[model samples]
Target: MALMITDDCINCDVCEPECPNEAISMGPEIYEIDPDKCTECVGHYEEPQCKQVCPVNCIPFNPAWRESKEQLMDKYLRLQADAK
Candidate 1:
């Protein structure tokens, strides 16, 4: 599943660099996650790097973008291919 940053985000700028998928970015008022790019670290790390570094614990699963592990891995692979 893709994760989203809530209003509770402090904009401390800690989570962006931690994302292996490069899915986090600064939004109008806070950081945002690109669901199309998010893979929950499926093919990169064992856990979500953004969530691990977010101090306020504002990053949460995006229910609207619910995805299974296989789907996430497929996305990861596609991203990897695109990067090449």
Candidate 2:
């Protein structure tokens, strides 16, 4: 599943640099996560880096964009391929 930044985000500018996929960015108010680029760190890490470093715990799985582990991995592979 893709992760999302909630309104509780303090915009401390911490999560953006942590994303391997470059999925997180500054939104109109708070930080936002791009679902298309979000792989939940499947190809990069055992855990979501942004969530790990988020101070306010605002990052959460987007229930609306639910995805299976296999799907996430596929996305990760595709992203990796695209980079090359």
Candidate 3:
């Protein structure tokens, strides 16, 4: 699943840079995750880097954007291909 930044986010500015897919960005009030670009770091790291660096633990799996590991990998591959 893609991760989401909750309202509980402190806006510490740590999570955005950690996202390997460049999915996280500043919203009107806080950080937001783009479900289209998010891969949960499946192809880049063992864990979601945004969640790892988040201080408030506001980053959580978005049930609305649920995806399997294989699906996440496919997204990662597509992202990599698009980068070229």
Candidate 4:
């Protein structure tokens, strides 16, 4: 599943650099996550890096977007190997 930033987001910019997949970004004000680029850090880290650094705890799973572990891992690898 992809993660999203809620309105409660403080725009602290803490989560942006922490994302292994580079999914988070600065938007008009709050930070945003691209679902297509999000893999929940499935193959990159033990846990979601964005959620860990968010000061307001505004990052939450996007219920509308869901994918299996294998699919997420595939996405991770594709990004990982893109520079190869």
In candidate 4, stretches whose alpha carbon ends up further than 4 angstroms from where it belongs are none
Deviation in angstroms for 71 in model 3? Answer: 0.3
Ten contiguous residues minimizing lDDT sum, candidate 3: 51-60
Flag clash pairs in model 3: none
lDDT of 1 by residue, 1-84 (tens): 799999999999999999988999999999999999999999999999998988889999999998999999999999999999
Give the per-residue lDDT digits (tens) of candidate 3, residues 44-79.
999999999988899889999989999999999999
- Compare candidates 2 and 4 on lDDT and give the better one: 2
Superposed on all Cα atoms, model 3 deviates from the true structure by an RMSD in Å of 0.5
Off by over 4 Å in 1: none
Model 2 Cα displacement at 42 (Å)? 0.5
Report the Cα lDDT for residue 51, model 4.
91
Report the error of model 4 at residue 29, Å.
2.2
Residue pairs with colliding backbones in model 4 are none
Which residue pairs in model 1 clash with each other? none
Candidate 3: what lDDT?
0.94
Model 2, CA-based lDDT: 0.95
How far out, in Å, is residue 51 in model 2? Answer: 0.6
lDDT of each: 0.94, 0.95, 0.94, 0.89
Q: Once all C-alphas are superposed, what RMSD does model 2 give against the true structure?
A: 0.6
